[model samples]
Target: MGTFQIEGGHSLQGDIRPQGAKNEALQILCAVLLTPEEVVIENIPDIRDVNKLIGILGNLGVKVKKLAAGKYSFQSDDLDLDYLESELFKQEGSSLRGSIMIVGPLLARFGKGYIPRPGGDKIGRRRLDTHFEGFIKLGADFRYNREERFYGVEAPNGLRGTYMLLDQASVTGTANIVMAAVMAKGTTTIYNAACEPYLQQLCKMLNRMGANISGIGSNLLVIEGVESLGGCNHRVLPDMIEIGSWIGLAAMTRSSITIKDVSWDDLGLIPDTFRKLGIQLERRGDDIFIPSMESYEIQSDMDGSILTISDAPWPGFTPDLLSIVLVVCTQARGSVLIHQKMFESRLFFVDKLIDMGAKIILCDPHRATVIGHDFHSQLKATTMVSPDIRAGISLLIAALSAKGTSAIHNIEQIDRGYERIDERLRAIGAKIERID
Candidate 1:
């Protein structure tokens, strides 16, 4: 394991070009299994999750080639279904939640699929019932082994499209069913679908591959199944999560940083969410520029009441950024409630923030009330280990703005999402060093 020793109280000042979206890249990579032709993906982030997904593909007999830095070419002409039963496949496949998406394409093309229980940040009970419900609705027979903790599905007659409404707006569930529906026999109408930017990109890419899909940016998606899809080159969009992390880092360190290659149009409600905490960001052409301000104050309601920033489905504040928002709220001038509705355990990391001298109240498993410091008193640095990706970045931001040195262990978790995070922060004048 590696650790980041950061000398805090340094302002970050430089230009950062955001990498490709890890979420989008993983889905697109799995979509390669929908066809046997070569698909080239550009701007793929060199992160651990991406690499792990690529390994899964290769182990399943898909040909994945790294054509260039942040570029990959994948061809799944000879997919080996038996690989899914291997121990190596089971172990690595369950390591990330994104791995569950592979079940859709595998079932679509091969008429059957098996996946072990998917693992990710232990935030809450992330049930696969929605995904299984979608699969069964599409003509798949599902079964589970309690002892083995493995899920299996068989579509002997192939999948036929149907109209279905998801119980909730599950992002990965939406992506999984969408991929399955693209190759079904008839039409699939998905209501209450997740229409996040990553899903939009997936839909656009499927369209480019000859699948017919409508309602690209709305909750309702209509997909007309096709016999097969062709290969096409698609460029993943810039990482919005990284953009939010950088925004928090800049605000916490009182730094001026310009994040280039940001897709302002795809940033739905992110800027407004930051603005709620009085972090003003300006858009220059396509980039988001955060300037150094003397202090940031939380925006109150018209009745002079404290505002709550909460997460919902798409077009709402993203749950992934709530940790970063909590860290940013610590530097703001007033109090704000950071409600992480999607994940029950995500707010558990606020105790670490409290250890750093931030006033936080963990009201429940899903909510935290943060009282900002306004930089009136400096936060004391302390050694901590990263629990998950978002929490890791949040702790790093808090460390960067603290009064002394802090050591962050388990950096591998941070590297799973953010690409070359330490190097990137160093470029922006952050005094962070990596030690093995």
Candidate 2:
């Protein structure tokens, strides 16, 4: 296992370019399966999750060629659907939550799809009910095998579009259904759909491939099914998750950092959430400049009550960034309630924060009340093992802001999403080193 040894209390100052969105890249990669022609994808992040998904595509006989750095051409004309049942496929597919999206396209094109229980951050009960429900609405039959822990779906009559409302605005769930509906036989109306930038990109790509879709950036999406999809080139948007992490990192260490090429429009509710903690940010065109602040305070409600920041579906504060926000709030001057409504185990990471000398009360698995120390009483750094991608980054931010040296183990977890994080942070004046 590798670990990052970081000496804290250093202010990061530099212009760092954001990597491509990991979430968007994964869905777009899988969307390539809907066409047999070569689809060129650019600005893809070189991260563990994206690499693993590419491996999965290769196992399925998709011809994946890297033409240049951060650019890939995928042609699935010879893709073998039988590999979906292979042991290697099952093992790799179970490692990522995004793998569940393959089901929609595989079933739509090949008439059947098989996947083991998809694995991802153990934040909470990320249910597949919404996915299965969407498939069933599109005329697919699902069967779950408890003993093998695999889920299979088939649509004998092909997918026929139908009106459906998602139980919740699950990001992956919405992507899955959108992929399926694009090739259905009739008009598909999806209500309460996830309208995140990632989903918008997926819709735009599908539309470029001749799939008729309307309401690209709203909760209501209408798709007129196309018989087939053609290939097209797509460039991914900048990673907002990385932007949020960097914002938190700068705030915790009182650093002045500039994030370049960030999609300011796609960063819905993110800047506002950071503003709640009094982190001053200035937007110069597409770049975000986080100025070093002498003091940061949690903005309370109009009635003078402690502010509550929680996660909801799309266009709301993303649940993925809750861990980072929780860590950032620790260095703020006041108290804030962090409600991680979507995930049960996400807020449990606060114990590590508490150990770092921050005052935090874990109300339950879903909520925590954090009282900031404003870095007046610096946390003495120690060894910590990362748990998940978001939590891993959160711990890294905490370690960077703490005093003394901290050894962060399981850095691979962080690498699953963020690309060359140590290198990026080092360029920005952070004192961090990766050691095996």
Candidate 3:
């Protein structure tokens, strides 16, 4: 295991570019399977989970080439269908949650998709019901092997488009259903779909490759079946979650950091959510400039009640960012309640913060009340293990803002999402070193 030894209270000052969107990359990379043509994608983040998916594709006989840094082309000309039943495939497919998305494109093109239990952050009950139910609605056979703990979907008769009203706005489920419906025989309408920038980008990319899809930025999507798809070049948007993390880090350590080429329009409700905690940031054309501040205070409601920050679907605060918001609020001027509705286990990481002298009340698995220290009291260094991706980054931000040095083990969780985080943060004058 590796650990990050971070010396806190250092003011980071530099221009740091956010890596490409990890969530979108997961979705977009899987979309390459919908066609046999060469789909060239740029700005692909080099991270563990992503690389694992790419390896899985290579094992499946997809020609993945690295054209340049963060640029690659994939051609699924000779997919190895039997490989899906191999033990190697099961071992690899179980390591990343993104593997679940490949099922859609496989079932759409090859009439079958198989996956071992997908592995990802243990934040909450991330069910595969929405995905399987959507596929069943679109004329696929779904089955689960209890002993092997595997999922399979097949449509020997071929997929036929149909209407599906999702139980909730599931990002992966929406992407899966879209990929499957693109090759269906008739029209497909998906209501209450996830309309995040990630899904929008997927739809746009598919359309470029000859899939007829409409309503890119809304909950409802309409897809007209296409015979086949060709390759297209796609560049993913900036990682909004990473951008939000940078914003929180800047506020916690009172640093001046400029994030370049951030797709501001795609960052729905992210900037304004940070502003709620009194973080001052300005947009310089396409860049976001967070200046060193003397003080930042949290904003309350109009009725003077303590503000409540909660996560919702698109155009609302993202659940992935609530961890960062909770960490940043620890140093704010007022108290706020954080409701992480999507995931039950995410808020449990705040106990590490409480150990470091922050005043936090863990109301339940989903809610927490944080009374800010407002820079009057500083977090003391402590040792902790990273639990998940978002929570891991949150702890890193807290460690950087603490008074002494903190050691965070299980940094592999952080590495799964953020690319070379310690190295990148060190470039921005942060005193963080990766130790094995």
Candidate 4:
């Protein structure tokens, strides 16, 4: 495990660019398995999860060529199907949540897919039922081995597209099903699909690759089966979760920072959510300028109720940003309720914040009421273990804004999502050092 030694109380200033979308890269990397042609992807974030997926792809015999920094071309023409059943695959696939996405494209192209129970941050119960159910709806045979903890999807006669109404707006599940349905025999209509920018990017990229897909930014998607897909160049949008984190960091540390090339139009409700907490930010062209804040207060509702910040499906406040918001609220002028709806265990990390002298009431596993410290009482730095990716970044932001130097252990959790976070933060005048 790695640790981050962060010295707090210093303001950060500079232009920082958000990395390519992590969620989008997970889906897009898996989509490369759909076609045998060269799919050139730009702005691929070199994070642990993404790198793990790319390594898995290379191990499965996909020709992965590095075009440049943040750019790569993948060709699946020489895929090794037998590799999927190997012990190496079983072990490696179990370590990555994105491994489940490979099942859909593999079942679509190779008529079979096998995956060990996928693993990611232990935020909550991440069910794969949606992915399996979608495959079954598309005429794929689904089987799970309880003892081995492995899932297999196979369609010997090839997949046939059909209507699917998802149980929930699951991002990965939607991406997997969409990838499978694209090459199926007929038209597939997916209702209640996740319409996040990640999915929209996937749809656009597939369209560019000759897959017929409509409904770019809505909950309903229509995909017409295509005979084959060709190569296409795709550039991922900026990471909105990271953008939200940066916004929170600036507010907490009273920094003046500009997030450049943020793909502002695709950010959805992210900026407004931070603004709800009275964050001062401006959109200059595609960049977000977060001015150094002296003191900002959380806005109460129009009816004079305590402000409540909650997560919802896309076009609503993203669940991922709720952690950043929760951390930022600890430094705001007023109190706010943070409700994390999607994950049961995400808010458990608030205990660490409470330990740091922030006034927080853990109402439940999903809700917390935070009374802002407002710099009148800054958090005292302490040691902490990173629980998950989002929570880790949240804690890091908190640490940077605290009064003393704090050490965060298990920083691998943070690295899984954010690419070289310490280096990037250091470049922007953050006093952070990575300790091995």
State in Å the error of residue 239, model 1: 0.6
User: Which stretches of candidate 3 lie above 4 Å from their native place?
Assistant: none
What C-alpha lDDT do the candidate models reach, one value each? 0.92, 0.91, 0.94, 0.94
Residue 115 in model 2: lDDT: 92
True-vs-predicted CA distance for residue 128, candidate 2, Å:
0.5
Tens digit of lDDT per residue, candidate 4, span 1-436? 8999999999999999999999999999999999989999999999999999999999999999999999999999989999999999999999999889999899989899999999999989999999999999999998899999999999999988898899999999999999999999999999999999899999999999999999878999999999999999999888999999999999999999999999989988888888989998898999999999899999999999999988999888999988899889888999999989999999999889998999999999999999998889999999999999999999999999999999999999999999989999999999999999
What candidate 1 gets wrong by more than 4 Å, as runs, is: none
What are the clashing pairs of model 3? none
lDDT of 1 by residue, 258-360 (tens): 9998999999999888988898799999999999987999998889888899998989888999999999988789999888888898988888989999999
Rank list by lDDT:
3, 4, 1, 2
Question: Model 2: per-residue lDDT, tens digit, 137-174?
Answer: 89999899999899999998899989998988888899
Q: What is the descending TM-score order?
A: 3, 4, 1, 2
Give each model a TM-score.
Answer: 0.99, 0.98, 0.99, 0.99
Query: Once superposed on the true structure, which residue ranges of model 4 sit more than 4 Å away at CA?
Result: none
lDDT of 4 at 180: 92
Model 2 Cα displacement at 353 (Å)?
1.1
For model 4, name the residue pairs that clash: none
Candidate 3's residue-wise lDDT over 274-319, tens digit each? 8888999899999999999867899999999999999999988899
| CA shift of 393, model 3, Å | 0.6
